[model samples]
Target chain A: MHRTLHPLTSLCFILFFFVIALFGAPTTQMVGVMILLSAASSIRKRKQAWKKIALYILPIGILLFLVNSAFGAPFSRGLAYALRFVLLITPLVIVLLGGSPTDFRLGLRTVPIPSRLHYLFIFSFEIIQSLRDVFQAVYIGQQLRGYNANRSLGNKWKNIFPLLLPVMLIAISQGLDRSLAFEFKGIESPAEKIYLRTLTLSPFDKLSIAILLLSSLGLIVASFILP
Target chain B: MITIKDLSFRYKQEARNSFEHISLHLQDGQALGVIGPSQAGKTTFAYALAGLLQKHFRGGSLTGTVIFDAQDQAPGTSEIGFVFQDASLQLSGVTETVEEEIAFSLEQFGVPRDIMRERIEEQLSTFHLIGLRYRHPKTLSGGETQMLAIASEAAKHPRLFILDEPTQALDADHVRHLIDFLRVAKRSSTIIFIEQNMSATFELCNHVLFLENGRQQFLGTPHDLLNSNIDVSSLTLPELIDVQRSLGRNHISLLFKETIEWMKKCRTSA
Candidate 1:
């Protein structure tokens, strides 16, 4: 049976990779983790994930290489940072593919975060959920209104100001409306909130976390002793 | 049931009050159609009734007792389901998929997972949105989003349901569906139906609350508003309502099919 792991498990795994990227030697182990994580994301999500990595990571990584090489730093040093960036991002993509926003929030709620911040986290997802579509509609609306987006770079830059303002205004106004919606829905009730998705640390989850932490600790020891 | 006495509200930034001394008494299961020109304070009135004026919009100055039964419920609670004019505003926006959006309100109300699933499916099919169940609600067209908002609110089955221009983004077919939806809803819920267009309200509503310059000009039945000497050009009815009115029919429905049947009956009776 395909049992879904708890969201906190992925979160903890992601934190482990962050630690690895920070402390571990720039070795084949990091590369292996990167490859495994990137591949583990479902094909449908990985398609978009790869696009983001290509668009953002490739440019930043190449830029770092150039800047470091220009400053007389070893080319491999810049490559290490690029790989570290990959380590930081891959687990995030895995979590997005494997888990959901609700699970993520519920998992966060398990942590000792402030109540206001927790509320903000939940409220923000709501805004993003609708604002994304509203922004698209605004773009289409502008196009239909004869303001084409596919113009010269200078013209496109000019259009961005107007486009951005309406999108922001719509988002802000709709956000206020959604706050009211939350109130009407009893989301902000002083009453205790019941989370439907139980966040149990399954035996597999415990085993996975233990294995992940041990591997990172072993890597840390090896990095210092091998040198 | 709701009772609003001596209600006067003014936005902190505005030069004048949105509405003043607006007293209303809505009995259980009564559907009141609020019609007026632009800036008639229909929305403000809705906010006041929903207890949004003071509770949510804190900067505003509001005076009056807007009471719902002896229970004295707080403003904007689960008892009132408001579908705002901008349909997107009505959406909770927290859920990823349309199905989740429809169920978000129910989840907040602490509904069982199984029932939430059932109602989500039922709403999806009822709103003809079964195909878009997995799609992001924010990515939907205006009509689809509006339908989602309505379905989401209806799923909770709140006692006082307020819809502000719910059909503004919808087509005639969807408007018909809404009227049918309201037909069933009115048997239990009190409806505060606000619309610039008088189309679906003619069938879905019983009482009318006509406002002008934020004053209660008339509060009576749909038939009374049609028969009374009120200039309704500003209300913006579809062409069919204008034609039916021109033909001396006091009771005109925006639903073309129903209007056609009514016309046939009138001709045969004559």
Candidate 2:
């Protein structure tokens, strides 16, 4: 079902969840709504994806809880805040993990956003992903050469410059190469771009959007009524 | 036809030009091999030919007249496809699947969806990427990625193709495949092939341009290049050519197969 949803439909749900997370009352009911939405978005995702989402949320949630408790907040209040943070961030991670950059571009096309802006947005994700891969490769290479960052705290700090210098140089070179590649492909041509796969609102997509709207309305109403 | 005259370029803040006084003329449907050692400005020359040096290198100073007299009117950069040396960097990172990577350029060109599909399928088949059509472009091996890069550019069917050291990272099998592809590609597209391998250059190119220290040392047919006195010791010259040079046999064929046949004839005659 997640695979069949149009990019626009998925984006609509994501925006809906984000708006609720931002504006709704920080109540247990709101967190429950977020959990339901996040679970629905992640239904078709893999276990690895779920672990990634948890990895994103857990450390921050723990930090938030620790900080709140240190500030003399009640245990229940701190736990609730931590849980709220987890619920608020989970859906976004799920959507990002579930969709590819191509899907994001497809979704952006229907909007009146400037083509360059959307292209930049999409390329930022790709650049970060590629840079992460490069950093991992460099890190592993250094580790194999016996430059262990795990040796001590000072060693970790000492290894930072040597590790980052090559990655930064490669990043700059790769950025130039990528821009040239993009130019050769005519990405900025004045011609009206055409898509190989057209995005149409299927019945499933319509249903998804409809469900999203109804769920948001119900959640807002429940938030106002609940204690 | 492509004609370049008095071409020279220097990057901003550089004391000397990267390459200077290089000129060549290639008829339509011909291949020109550009060979030289490192820092000979081979890639810079390629960028100039592709019109990128002027269009993209805004900080650089360029002086030259590059005329691409194609069948159509004045050719824009769109009529030229360039494959960089690094196949990984050449890929459009936004695409997920192999077929999408090929369709990416066509989409930007605003090709009709039906025509785009046809071109994508044709390129996939041509580059032997049909089996990996649904696979992620990032997951492909080095050779497969290189093939995808070439396939993506070839799908454009540009008037000219500039391949910069394409076989550098390729193994023997992939090299043979690339040679086969170029043999077919050269019939339609004028090719500026920058290569280190002497045999592939001699086999695939009609004309050769030898660059050294930012200077055009030689420019002519491969036969003329071999006959010329310009030192080519830096290049990995084919064994037969080396042997011929050592034996003072200037009449030796530039092609390995032809030289082998010549050796057979010599033995039979004796």
Candidate 3:
């Protein structure tokens, strides 16, 4: 019952807009895809998550529009481009707000990267995991050692330094050994090259891709017609 | 096929020598088990012997003769391939599949494409890891990871194989598999199996060296140390030794056989 999204899919969700924009996709299509992704992610608690994104985005979007009008570089183009940026930003906010760490892990797994760079890629996440452990270990150790950590600024600040060094050292030593263990198991120095599994372009994905393509073509057509 | 005399080294910042007055000789096809308590310089000794500590990690004055195959050797070209205690740390590949793990090493060794493919298949089945070839090592259990480590190392047949506590994280079944692999490899290569697992020491060691507090406590056959029971408190041993002692069977062959029989009985009962 514990379903997890693949790391590749998470990555795709985050970067799909960037890819679209890079490939000269249109703003409305990008916006539509981003909204779709964000909406999908926020399904469980749609209003709360979606509301937060809108609040943060709406103000900046208005400011950008105002600036574009003042400078006046093709109002439609500016609007489209500004919308494209918004599309790119929404998934990240949704991912950060709505997704669990497991989602990020799944996203990494789904990354369409080359095999040779896999360890390096995974290692970056491992470093973050270790850092998170370091904090939790230190906090637990502090609690066990009878350091009272009440909900007060001064008291919390006082306990910080006393617990910091020991935790850091323990975490560093353990992390090194763990990293070495990872290498020992042939994870660090694999014997073969591997490639990401070929992506099956589903109807949804194809629809998304086609919309992006057509949106880009429409932008080109609109420029010619207007001129 | 390794000779070291008057070898000594000190880390860059540390005042005391990591190793000093170290002299040893290992013959081809001979297996030597290195034993020591935690941080008692077992890894340091192995690293020095393999020329990794001196060459890569540590920098210090070392005045000694390390003659590999009776030839004067430089650092980093050591024929000894090392597998450290932590199987997870030793792996450096990014792929999720077992095939990639073995193939990565073979590629590093510069084996040709056709030979690499053949060797990959051979090792996959040899290590009994063919079923999990497409699985990521991270998803594997501890024993499977250990097996993968050995399998990857086995892909590269080094002249002198140095394994540091190779079976520490493995279960009995996987440990037995590793011992079997080492025993087979011993036919051609000299093994320097550094471990705290005394049962494995007794089972596979032709010779054993006990180190404590950065000093060599005893060096002889397993029977000598197990029988004498002197100056070995610093060295770690398997729990079965204590069990056999309680069973009052200190006889070398009887103690060993009894431990195996007892393990078998437990397995069957379970």
Candidate 4:
């Protein structure tokens, strides 16, 4: 669905879920949405998406719970705060799992944004993606070199510096290289930009957007009316 | 014509210049091969020729002029295409597929969709990327990525091309393709070809610039660079040249066929 749907439709879907997660009441509705998103990810064969969401949600969620409880908040309040964290992050991870930088740029192009801003947004995502790959490679290299970060908590803490320094240096070098490449490609040329593969809303894309919009409105209304 | 006069550059806080006192004149549609050992400022020379040393390298002092057709045009204004040594870094990550990657530059130039399509099709076929047109750029192998990088730049048909070790990642077959492409490219574009592969330098370039320790060692034809008394021990000379030197032959054959014929004569006489 992500591959076939119009970028605008996907953008709307992502935005709708984000809004719901942000403002929708901390009730079964939010949980339902989270479950639905995870299910969507599963159906799309992004099996690792939910696991990645969990990996992030668990530690931070527990930390939030502990902090709230330590501050004398009720158990239910602490749990709700933790659930809010989960709700906040799921949409972002879902988007990351399904969308590439190109999709983000294409989606942003539908808005009346400046081209420079468009490049900023796209390059930010590109850098993040590049850094992710760099981090993975560095981590594997460290592991192969017997500096196992998983051996113990102490080792994990100790390995952070070695892993981080190279990644940062490589990221900086790559950033410079990417900027030079952009210039070489005439990315900032004064000529008006054009798209070879133009985006068009298909019937399914329209239907998806409509359903998302209605669902979002229903969620907002239900949030106001519900206890 | 592309002309550089007494060009020199020093990186920020560096003790010595990267390369200095370099000058060369290359006619239009001529290819110049830049050869040097590691840290010999070959890439610096390339960046300078592409008009990137001043713009991209902040705080780096660059002296002298690089004029294109007798005009000192601002960077990115002229059609100066550069292919960096690291092919992966050359990719515009905003493009998803190989075909879009080729079109990314054309789109930036605002080429009409029809012409853009024609150029994209031509590049895909020329670079032998038709089968991988829809594949994501990140998923390509090193050689394929290098080809894609070259193809994307080649699609622009720039007036001047600055390629830094463009064949480093390519296999033999792809290297041949690149040589063929460059052979055609140099007919219409002034090319600054920086390569460590001596055979490629001999095959593609009419002029050669040799640098060492931030200074020009020699600047002339490939044949002269090999035949001259200057020290070329740092470079990996082609096997044929090494064999010629070992056999105490003063004359060097630049063509492989001619060299093979000479070897046949020597064997028959023996």
For lDDT, the strongest prediction is 4
Question: Candidate 2 chain A, which ten residues in sequence have the lowest lDDT sum?
Answer: A28-37
Candidate 3 lDDT, B28-61, residue by residue in tens: 8888988877867788888777765655564567
Q: Which window of 10 residues has the lowest lDDT sum in candidate 3 chain A?
A: A190-199
| Candidate 1 RMSD computed on C-alpha atoms after optimal superposition onto the true structure | 4.9
Q: What TM-score, over all chains together, does every model reach?
A: 0.78, 0.85, 0.67, 0.81
Clashes of 3: 49
- Of the candidates shown, which would achieve the greatest TM-score relative to the real structure? 2
DockQ of each: 0.44, 0.72, 0.13, 0.58
Q: Model 2, range A1-227, lDDT digits (tens) per residue?
A: 45745677777677666556644665643565556455645556657556865576778888887888776778866666676676667666667667765656676776676667877887788888888899999999988998777778887888777889899999999999988988888887889988787556778878888887787787778777876
lDDT of 4 by residue, B104-214 (tens): 889888888999999999999988999999999999999999999999999898888889999899999999999999999999998889999998988999999999998
User: What clash pairs does model 1 have?
Assistant: A126-B93, A126-B94
What is the lDDT for B256 in model 2? 73
Best by DockQ: 2
Chain B only, TM-score of each candidate: 0.87, 0.92, 0.86, 0.96
Chain A, candidate 3, TM-score of 0.55
Candidate 4 local lDDT, A49-105, one digit each (tens)? 767756776789789878887867788777777777776676666666676555556
Query: iRMS values in order, in angstroms?
Result: 2.6, 1.2, 6.2, 1.6
Candidate 1: what is its chain A TM-score?
0.67
Q: Compared to the true structure, candidate 2 yields what TM-score?
A: 0.85
What is the C-alpha lDDT profile of model 2 across B110-178, one tens digit per residue? 889999999999898777889999999989999999999999999898889999999887888878888
